[model samples]
Target: MRIQLDDLQGPEIHALLEEHMRGMHALSPPESVHALDLDGLRQPNVRFWTAWDGADLLGCGALKQLDAEHAEIKSMRTAEQHLRKGVARALLAHIVEQAQALGLRRLSLETGPVPGFAAAHRLYQAFGFQECGPFADYKLDPHSVFMTRLL
Candidate 1:
């Protein structure tokens, strides 16, 4: 799969992100749903990417710079038809590599604690992310699970 910087304008990506938002809201309470919409992901501090095989969009992920040395992972989602196909893994590995290339010292993320998010938790843990307290504008909440890793 080819992972490339995304401009967030394609219909395919828009549909995928909308699906991601719906899934997030379905799994977690409104207050605990931290997933970024298209506008949020388009912010200057955020860099987004999409993985594709020819015309098929496999997955996407983003990194939002919180500071010169810290960044937060956002909007990670694998297309429903592409789950368990390493699409997320490829996007995540690409994001981490890009973060390191940017000279960022840490990478963090917030995800839901429900069974629906089990695969995500395992994926992050396998990538060396460990549970941590809230960071950035986040507050401690039972519906959220925070994880971070030093670059």
Candidate 2:
């Protein structure tokens, strides 16, 4: 799959992100849902990308720069039909590589603790991410599981 920077303007991506937001809200309570909307992902500090297999959009992910040496992974979602096909894995690997290239010293992410997030937890763990307390603007929430890794 070809993974590249995305401008977030395509209808396919818009639909995907909308689906992502809906899924997040469905799995977690309103207060626990941290998934960004289209406008939020368009912020200057956030860099977004989409993974594609020729004409098919496989998945998408993003990194939000929190400071000079820190970043947070956000909006990671794989298409429903593409689950278990390494779409999320590829996007994550690409995000990590890009973070290192940006000279970032740490990468952090917040995901849910529900059954729906089991695969995500395993994915982060396999990439060397360890559970951590809340970072950035986040507060302690039982619904959230924060993970981080030093670059």
Candidates in order have lDDT scores of 0.96, 0.97
What are the models' TM-scores? 0.99, 0.99
Model 2: per-residue Cα lDDT over 17-134, one tens digit each: 9889899999999999999899999999999999999989989999999999999999999999999999999999999999999999999999999999999999999999999999
Candidate 1 per-residue lDDT, tens place, 53-109, comes to 999999999999999999999999999999999999999999999999999999999
Clashes of 1: 0
Clashing pairs in 1: none
Could you tell me the TM-score of candidate 1? Answer: 0.99
